[model samples]
Target: MYPFLRMVKELIKFRNAPAMRVGDIHISEHRCWPWDIDLWAELNNGRTLTLYDLGRIPLAQRAGLVSVMRKNGWGMTMAGVSVRYRRRIRTFEKIEMHSRAVCWDDKFLYLEQSMWKKNGECANHALYRSAITDASGIVAPERVLSAMGHSAQSPEPADWIKRWIEADAARPWPPMQDKR
Candidate 1:
C-alpha cells in the first residue's frame, strides 16, 4: 500500500521550508514502523524503495521541480535504480534519509539517496534514474531544468553513475528463456 498520508505529512512539514538548488541536499527523518518490516523482522526491500519516495518527492519540491511539473502537466516516473542494503533497520528504528540530485543527462536525471541510522551507520543507499514526461513523451532533462528556471547546462555526472548508465544501456531490453 502507498504511504500517501506520510507523504502528505512530509509535504506539509516542508511547505514553508526554503527552496533549494539542484546541488543542495534534502534531509528528512523517518521511522521503521512494524508494518514496514518483512518476515525477517527488518525493513522490507520493497518498502525501502517506497519510503525513498518520501525523500525524493520532497527533494523535487525543494528544487522547484514539482511546481513546474504541476503547471506544465508533466509527470515523473522512475526509469531505473540500483540499490545496496548494507545494514538492517529494526522496527521502531529512526533513520535519517538524505537525498540529492547528482546530475542529469539528455534523457534522465540521476539522484543519490541514503538511509542512515541513528548510530551513524548507513543502512542502505541507492542511485535512481528518473524521467519527466508529458502528453508527448519523456521530456528532456534540459527542458525540465529550464522549466524549473535553471540553465540547461548540467553538471558532470559521477564516473560510477556514468558507468552504470552504460552498463544498463548494454543490457537486453527483454529476457529470453525456453521451456524445459
Candidate 2:
C-alpha cells in the first residue's frame, strides 16, 4: 500500500508537468513502414489518419507508458477518441509523433497527441480519453482520490456505458455496397 501511494504521487506530479512543444516529446523516431501505413489506412476507414494506429505508437516506443501508469496505481481504459487528419502520408516517408498527458480527474485521463512530417507540419491530431477501472471493469473512483491524497469524495460513475450503448444502437452498420 505504501508503494502504491508513492507511485501515485509520482504519477500525479508527472501529469502536472508543464506543457512543452510537441517536438519535445520524442516517439520511436523510426521511419514509417508500408505495413504500418496499411494498418492505419484500414483502421481509419481508408482515410489518412487512424486513432487505432496512432494508439499503437506508444507501444512501439518500448516506454511501457500505459503499463507504467497502470502499475503506478492508475487505472487505464479507453473512453473515447477523436482524430483529425491533415495530410496523407506515403510509404517510406519519415514522420514523428508527440504525446503528452493533458489532464485528468478522479475518473478520467486525457491526452493530446499529434503527428508531423519531416518538414514539421502537423499531419494529424488526436484527443484520447481514458478511465481507471478495476479488474472487474468496475471503476474505483475512491482509489484515485486516495492516491491523489485528496479529501474530496469520489463522484458516482457517469452513465457513459449507457450512452455508449444507446449511440451504438442508433448507428447500425451500413448495408454491403457489393452483394455477392
User: What TM-scores do the predictions have?
Assistant: 0.97, 0.50
> Where in model 1 is the C-alpha error above 4 Å?
none
84-138 in candidate 1: lDDT tens per residue?
Answer: 9999999999999999999888899999999999989999999999999999999
lDDT of each: 0.94, 0.50
| Per-residue accuracy of model 2 over 86-112 as CA lDDT, tens digit each | 876666776676665454455554556
Residue pairs clashing in model 1 are none
Q: Which 10 successive residues of model 2 have the least lDDT summed?
A: 42-51
Clashes of 1: 0
For all the candidates, what are their Cα RMSDs to the real structure?
1.0, 10.4
